[model samples]
Target: MKKLLCLLLAVATVLAMSVLPAMAEGAEINMFISSPEYADAVNELIAAYKEVAPDVTINYETTQNDYPTLLKTRINAGMTPDIFSTTSGKEIADYAEYSYNFAGSPAAEAMDPAVSAMMVYGDGEIHGFALKGNYFGMLYNKAIFEEVGIEFPRTLDAFEAACEKLSEAGYQPVTTGFAEWWVFKHVMQHFLDAASDDPAALVAAFQKGEAHFKDYPVLYDNFFRFIDLCVKYGDNKPLETDLAGEDAAFGAGKAAMMTGQGAWVEADVLAIDDALQIGFAGYPVTDDPAKSQIIGGSDQALRINKDSANLDAVMDFVNWWYTSDYGKAWFCDVAGVIPPITDAKVADMQIIQQGSELSATDGAAALSICYSSDSFNQAMGEAIQAYIGGTIDKDACCAQIEAKWVELDGAAQ
Candidate 1:
């Protein structure tokens, strides 16, 4: 009876979501975004905007793989977008000169204090506001767990034991999308962060060329453990699977759980079976609970072009984004996105609830992007793929990644 009620609620929630109207107004705003990860949610938000404000058009453009370079090129060339998206920390510094200051807006005021601190710069100027804050860890199928008779695992040993049981029960223990560079990088960040005594300090040293992955035996061992998790229980030819395939496989109950996934996978999973119950938890990367933490934090932000002719419309949208109930509903209820507003309502979705609880605990770290570089992340990801593909030993993978970090540091000098 309880399961039936939950399924009905899920069905009704999807039904209540509004689709954007087919027609559009004349003016179109070119909005440059870094990735297609949030494309669907952004589109839904745009559609909702069109219904009330017909004249303002939002044309979404993605640089995808070439986002960082193209964004730099465009910003440097002064070919500014009417609106753009940004990530936390130094990433926003590149576009700070051209981004409009949101010093006194509702959006700025509503931002979480810590996240707001990351956006402010010279003279206390605010350059961007977080559009979505996410938690990344282990996303699992609740139904599979019930069948396997295993509760959530809070330690590495227990997690591995559950994986073994799930495998013996004729279910794939875990599903991963190592073929996708970002997915591999995401998992590596989680593993390395959990393995370190002070992930931030270690990463700072690595960034400064004072330390390397090989310098931390914990990282080296954990990297292999991560690989082992995928190799032992991942779907056949795991390296061949992409993000879409991995999500679909888990949605179809091919796997009991997926590590390194978070709230982002909820919609994809529920789409396959509205009745399927899903849950999320912190990745117990170590045997000791004190050291384990789920990777999460402010993932994306929104900024406006200081010189765009549509500043009024852009500002209007920005203000409306936080001040209006429609914006909150569209983001939280419709898109299942947790905006950074301090007053935002908690979504009734169970997986989101789980992520929130995990994030609030002492054992959670913000996505540690500030400590690593793009070159270093790419090298580590490639090495992990190679290691999992059976071409490189664990030591070779760690050594090459360390060498790549040193190489990247030298080139930066």
Candidate 2:
């Protein structure tokens, strides 16, 4: 297999000159962003950044139109942008040997430490900076809670009993769009993490081939419970419903609850029902002491390319995102993103208020960032889609994950 990052020097090849004029009078800088999810927000930020540095041009692209392949080719050709995201968990570690520290770097200190920590490499150096922080917990229908005469579930048994009641009343217990592979996997991982004490450690063990889901009965049981619930309560022909449809189903009051990140609660769903009385609770733990609360990390991370032509500008933008109050407010207020910057607060957002309250009393689950290699996510997604579709057996689905783990290990070696 060809190595992905610029791990080994490639044969000399002609490369395109993609660099744009920099913020400085004579410098040329081109900023390339890799996530499709943040393309609009990033462009908006770019517009703001250019107010101070009009000469600099921001070159933006999501992970779209085969850009991943194009990016790999560019990196190999040594035409890599001045600043580019590593894109996925696996890619971040490929260059870990030469990672930089944003902590002491002028751009980082303006933000809160907790958000900063998430951006650092395992070796404690910051390669990425927090664009913003986010909170991820369960979004439950407050109206449903009132109608059912139940409070948000705190224990695993209570959670199931609530599901049972919801099912009895013909109310879908959970709104899931397994049809969309990423949404399916994200929720599954959230449930497992919400219930686990050491989510990161458990995933690490699985990554190293030291553990399997079956080895963790809690994981297996939850997996079964989740799928069973889906079978029981999902909309008719749910396997046909796409992720957006799932969101619509839940947001439009077609479903009672959704296991999703906090990011979607206010922006996506609330718009559909402004009167929607929704509450967020941390992932429930079957085993009491193991309960963890989660505020999902922002998908927005900032990275500079090893070959970047305008490192200063890229770093400047990253710093502004964390340090500048205006920047923080856009993400928190307009976008409803939680600021990782410690002191930043939004007094008005209802979901933030709800999440802050839940987390305040240890009601939140300390959820881990659910990440592995890009291939790992893809493989898990494939298996999940297959299982949900009933096109594969459970053992077969587990086996697929194990196989992919070995495949990634071998390639990395």
Candidate 3:
């Protein structure tokens, strides 16, 4: 009788939780997207979900800035979105109801807890579903490297030597779109992973304000060393150059080495030239490989509406994502995101390989970009751009971020 009662209650709970349109009034659901690259991939996922319930319209909006702040502004304006994304480090409790909590969801049971933890917020409340993960490393053009005779960087010193060597070879080496600001993020994270053997230690430091501008001089020194190379080899004024321009350098064969995380940009690089042989290598490890901590994690995520008219459809979408063969097939073939399911097969993902190989060394990988708050991100970008443009010296560059750190509530890290 007890077992029967439990089964009855389970069915009743699922029924009570999902308010289908037939039972209640429902209409268009808006989703605020934080990433633009995977919109095509997301559209595919959404199309699959639509088959489960075709009445709902997906109202989507894209933004490059902090979506959390946007969420706050929208809420303040009396406009509450039905669904949105809330990253682990940037959670706001007011919007909790609008997110999916993976802890108790069927979606959570089908995958690794760590990946699910990527979307976790509040007191173990999961806010989203993290799909494919990302990693940081160097992207070298095959033709450019071969013509210049520069091999991928294996060690810190070796990378620096390559930077100097590439500069002398009439090749623009280590180009970044500092003008776009986020370009510096991945490289900084990679440098942190190399210098601090503990990936979580970096995350822990960021949360506790223990890391500083000078805590790891290697990043400061090596990054500046790289910036020096960029100034010498750039096709034109690098200060005015943006990520689009930086990408053009690689595509046009004007630059040799570029840093990237496994984001949607992979598609663009692959599309540029059929013959553009691309090789990816982890952030330059320290002299000792074991000490090289892999610093990156869950690439991006999909969240749900807390007040959805149909919880079943949302859960259906998430469950299908990990368990259904059709969902997995689309993700693998179209999106290239390795679903959380353990037995899920993944293709030759360069970023995953970079992080996985490092993990086998008995270390961890935390997404490097997760280290700073939104304000720190902008400040650091400004500093790097100023330094490259010669408007700020090394001391001024360091001081700029230090001052902004104090201004911003990010104590350190």
Best by lDDT: 1
The superposed Cα distance between candidate 1 and the true structure at residue 222, in angstroms, equals 2.2
User: RMSD of each candidate?
Assistant: 12.8, 7.7, 10.7
For model 1, which pairs clash? none
| Per-residue lDDT over 1-413 for candidate 3, one digit per residue giving the tens place of the 0 to 100 score | 99999999999988987855453234466667676666888787778767766775666677767776887787677566655665544443334665656577666676655465556676877676665655556677777778777677666677667777778887777766666777676666666666566755665554455666576666667656656655665547766677677667776666787764343455566567556666655666455544445444564556776656656655665677777777666656777764455556665555455445655565554565554555576777888888887887987887776666555634332
Please give the distance, in angstroms, between residue 139's alpha carbon in candidate 1 and its true position after superposition.
Answer: 1.1
Q: Rank the candidates by TM-score, best first.
A: 2, 1, 3
Q: What's the C-alpha lDDT at position 211 in model 3?
A: 62
Candidate whose TM-score is highest: 2
Compose the digit string of candidate 2's lDDT tens values, residues 263-313: 544667877888887777666645453363655454445566644556666
Q: What does the lDDT read for residue 295 in candidate 2?
A: 57
Give the Cα error of residue 195 in candidate 2, in Å: 6.3
| Local accuracy by lDDT, each model | 0.74, 0.64, 0.63
Least lDDT summed over 10 consecutive residues: which range in candidate 2?
9-18
